[model samples]
Target: MNQNSKISEDTIDLKELFFSLIAQWKIIALCVILSLICAMLYLRVTSDIYSVDAMVQLEESKGAASAALLGDLSKVTGGFGQKSPVDAEIEILRSRMVLGQVIHNLNLNLIVKDNSSGIMDKFLSQGRSRLTYQHDAVTFTNKQNSLIIKQLTIPEYYSDKPLILEFKDSNHFTFTYKDQVVFNGKLNQKNTSETNKGLWAVDINAQGELLKQSYTVSKLALPTAVKNFNAIYGVSEKGKMTGVIGLSYLGQDPEQITQILNNVLTVYHQQNIERKSLESKQTLVFLEKQLPELRKQLEDSEIKFNQFREKYKTVDVNAESELLLKQNIDLEKLKIELQQKQAELSAKYTNDHPLIRQIDAQISEINKKIADLNNRLTQLPETQRLYLQLYRDVKVNTELYTSLLNSYQQLKIANAGEIGNVRIIDTAVEPVHPIKPKKLIVLILSIFMGGFIGVLIALIRNLFQTGVKDSAQIENEFDLPVYATVPRSPIQETRMSILKKKKSIPILAVKHSDDIAIESLRSIRTAIHFALSSAKNNIIMISGPAPEVGKSFVSTNLATIFAQSNKRVLLIDADMRRGYMHKYFNLEVTPGLSELLSQQVSLEHVLHKTNVENLDVISRGKSPTNPSEMLSSTFFKELLETLSPLYDHIIIDTPPVLAVTDGIIISQYAGVNLMIARYAKSQMKELELSVNRFEQAGVKVNGFILNDIQRSSAGGGYNYAYAYTAQKDN
Candidate 1:
């Protein structure tokens, strides 16, 4: 049972909140409309960004020509299979060396713009390129603006500072800096001038509207230009180890970004070629140094072999000696080649390195073979051995020289034919559409976002409302039974409209007998009838926590309901200040309660008859200085005692309990004391304080009437509905 009750409470709170939001639908609608307007404006002002991209692949192998040129030396260099990693190559593409060249080629450091001053011009220019034309130079011109800068140079300190170029005609123009004329020059001619500030140099071509509009030109520092360019530049491998890179750049102009990206690819390709050629060039230089020495050594060996033949004269060697000579020469040639390979490897690697150590071991083995061939040569006859030694020296030198010469020419050819291990698969092209400012998506999101904010605001307002909404809440919280929950009436609203227009109010219960509010009052009448049965006298005092809680409305209308039940009723406005109850019955304010209380008028003179049968009215008289004193006097008590017995029911409308002590004092005379709390306006704390004030004065409030409820204040099931038409139900 407890759990079910908790669930019921939760459901009611949610239902109440839902209705609260419904009550504030206008706020949410306004927010949504505002959001849509802002979204449209943003779409208008944001420039379209076109994206251009290029695709390139990195080859795992160095060029075939380079590998072939190295020949045997390819083993030492890691051969054709060696290539830089994809990640490293990607970084190199974005390096300053590569991108800086692109920037310089495109002349990106200079900026030019049309001097658009009007709101329309600036608005229309949002999605346009800064310059009308850009290639080797930048050009900008319109009906009211013209500027073309072929060359511009400014000192470092003046970089990024804007200068205005105003034309006097098609041929002449003046450059101004900070409103000061810096230089005057003719178009299509080189101009150079020095001022106190800095030297200025420029070459310009101008046309159309030269005198009507000026243009702004600013030079950016090279580093700053490169940094700005890098902001839009992007490059990455398509997949891990794929070696396929995708490059992209975003900008307003389709043609400019396309050209820029293609240029970047071109420059990167050229640099890669240069990088590959550098290795072959280094190897050529090393080989060339050995060529001259090897040539001279071969010459000396030939001369010595001929001289030895001349000195010995008719020298002959046995076949065994000849065999040993060929063996020795072959061994020596192999040994020399090993030593040369060792020397070249030593330049790049320490002797302790694995490759170097392996080469050293091979060279040692070749040297031992050479030594054994030398011993076989020593076994020959003395003259024959000497002749064989010269033959071996000449053969070894000739073979070594020829090998070095061939390798040198191969390297030169390879260097000339070298191409980098990178290939461009697709070049960037002009984009047909922009990639940004997705209109549908942005507008859709804005709608949701705006609605979300509106709902949040509604919920926040509901959370902050401290007023009593539910009549059951007052009953449960304050332990005071609410006799009736009176809904707002269109008839009452019409009466208020008439009263505002200075007309009289029609008593609601008589005019709208079947009205829901009247029905609610009938319920209150029943409760009052039961309470009056045990009362000291038949009188009810109606007051509220604060003004504007519909206490007077309840008091006047409730009396009309009792009068309709055939009971003689008297409605008295006891409030001496700011009471206008007489307006309801088309009566004047003076000569009523205040006049009667002060004994300035007799009872018959103060009392007035209303249009409703069996009802009498007494309006609060003209403003008084001492109303509290008069109401508490014996005369007021005797007046009520005198009038109470004559009426079946008497309702006294008093001032707000919190505003003054009049209601508390009046409560002492009435048998039934009731407080009227307006729905969604009378705060719980305020009502609690008002009740406390009455209890402290030793008067117990009989009950409360929750008044002027709107649909939102009455949460779903128990909420009352009314048919507001003059047509009778058949």
Candidate 2:
């Protein structure tokens, strides 16, 4: 909006930005300290987590033929083709069934902890429990037991509250808070009851039922146990197509995580073995059904052979027939086995598969042996050949039955000895150190987070602010030359503050002559002398854009400086509504401006001489209901014109220009209108608007006084003391 502000818009002012940040180092430091304290508390309260991991390799079976049992695993774990089997295995490893078994075997759902003290520590604790849960009394002392919640269940309503168990005897106890019983129950016995929250069922652990212990034990639901275990368990392949699955789970306890991962692997291994044996069991069932038919066929063949021998009265067979019968019996058994192999292979593989081709070749070899036996059989007599045929039928059935029985026995052994395809490459070990809450990383992030929050707070404050922080912006925007930049006077600050609090004002020119503010006032005196040399009168009016912009302060000090320079001056507090110029000198507030303007007092009675030589004061005599009308009256103009010849300069301190019409009405009578703008307190728009009001009233605003310019850090913007000292020393 202002030329100085517009100049900053085209290019970012790095110096201002840096100084603004420097100005708020305390905010940044506070944020960082608070953040660090929170971070330390977090690290102290949070339990450390340890990672226990196990590696397993799901080696693809070479020729398993167990497809009926172990199907493609990829569908379960997510993948296609070659990746499916391992993924499926991984899913099974993390499945509810496997996790439930692990939880049940290890008693993982029995949660116990000491919660008798502070709520925060007990609630957030994942560390080793203070009260150790035991199955027997020999492991710990039982005589000093105070409270024992053998079993407890929390419903939704009372989930956040603690159950205080007050032990009365070994077999009896009560749930109480502040020594009042909420519920009564006996040890070792299961009981279901209703409370204010919900229904609950509980029982003491069976092994430790007889022992009295001051501890709490809670059994988690089966589904919840499985879910918790599943959340902690993780499985993934080590590398693409590597088939090396890495299984892990991290928790507060080293032993717990180690046991958890080991249990998961053990369950998976057992399940795999059972799955692999399923196919063998199905095939065994089918083979058992054929055993009876084979036995009957053998029996019938034997009866026919015996009957044929009796009817033929001892028909003789040559050695060739015997050899042929033996050969046919062996060849038939081999052929039957090859056919069975072919049938089993057809279920999983194509006709051209290696296993089928191998079986077919074996069948061909057996067929050749049968053909050779047939050729030799033709050489025997017809009767012997008939006996050979019957004998051959009996032999074939007997050999086939014997071979099938042996094969069944061998398959039973194989099924019994089945093991999982997946092998444990590395078992989980108890970790020596935790994996979480990296201290260095947390501290670094906390510092950065603090800085980020500080910047956001600064930005938000700046966004809502309309105050001008720079003095140049006032001159550029108001089209007024800044006569002086008054540095905050530390020398007179304490004394002036005390005087103001006592309903008086300090005279800085007499109290501290070399003060920075007084030096700037002298500068203003010189600037005004040159600027108003051609003016019609020496009566100058001082006002501000807003109240409390040090307008009274500027009027008193400048008048004092001019009087000290041997020029007669009168400082008039023209703000009839609220002005205090008599506070600077020891004089009464009445018999001043209001009395003079209202014609209630004469000019000599209204004007009061101050302690400073050649300087006189006129205070705002009384508060009037219609200040605007009174300042606009002809009496005020006549009073000023009447005193014009006596004083070298008549300085009138008026109320804020934009606040009321007093400054605008009085500015028309003055030679030059001057306004004071406090640093970082007044806005550029207010300065521009206040100047515009004077120009509209046919009075040209001479310039601005940027008052109370605060000192800044060295190398920052507008550190006048540092610059002045540096120049003086040079």
- What tens-digit string does per-residue lDDT give for candidate 1 at 588-621? 8878888888789988998999888999999999
**Displacement of the residue 191 alpha carbon in candidate 1, Å:** 4.3
Candidate 2 per-residue lDDT, tens place, 1-730, comes to 5564676657755655564555556677788888888788878776678899889888655323333222342132132112238778888887777887876666666555444435475456544243332222111112343223344555554443445544567667666544566667776687678887778765543224223334444456777777777787788989998989998897876876776688788888888777666556666665687788899999999999999999998876667666667768867976876565555445546889866787788789888888888887777778887788888888899888887777677666777767657788999999998889888899999999988888777656655655765666765566578887776676655565456556666677887788777887798877898877978789899999888788877888899999999999999998877777787796778877887777888888878888999998888888878878888988878888989999999999999889899999998889888888886678877887887788788889888887766535332235442312100000
Global lDDT of each candidate: 0.79, 0.71
Question: Could you tell me which 10 consecutive residues in candidate 2 have the lowest summed lDDT?
Answer: 721-730
The Cα RMSD of model 2 versus the native structure comes to: 8.3
Which ranges in model 1 have alpha carbons more than 4 Å from their true place?
Answer: 1-12, 72-80, 111-135, 139-146, 158-223, 287-413, 487-519, 556-570, 580-621, 633-649, 708-730
lDDT of prediction 2: 0.71
- Candidate 1 matches the true fold with a TM-score of 0.78
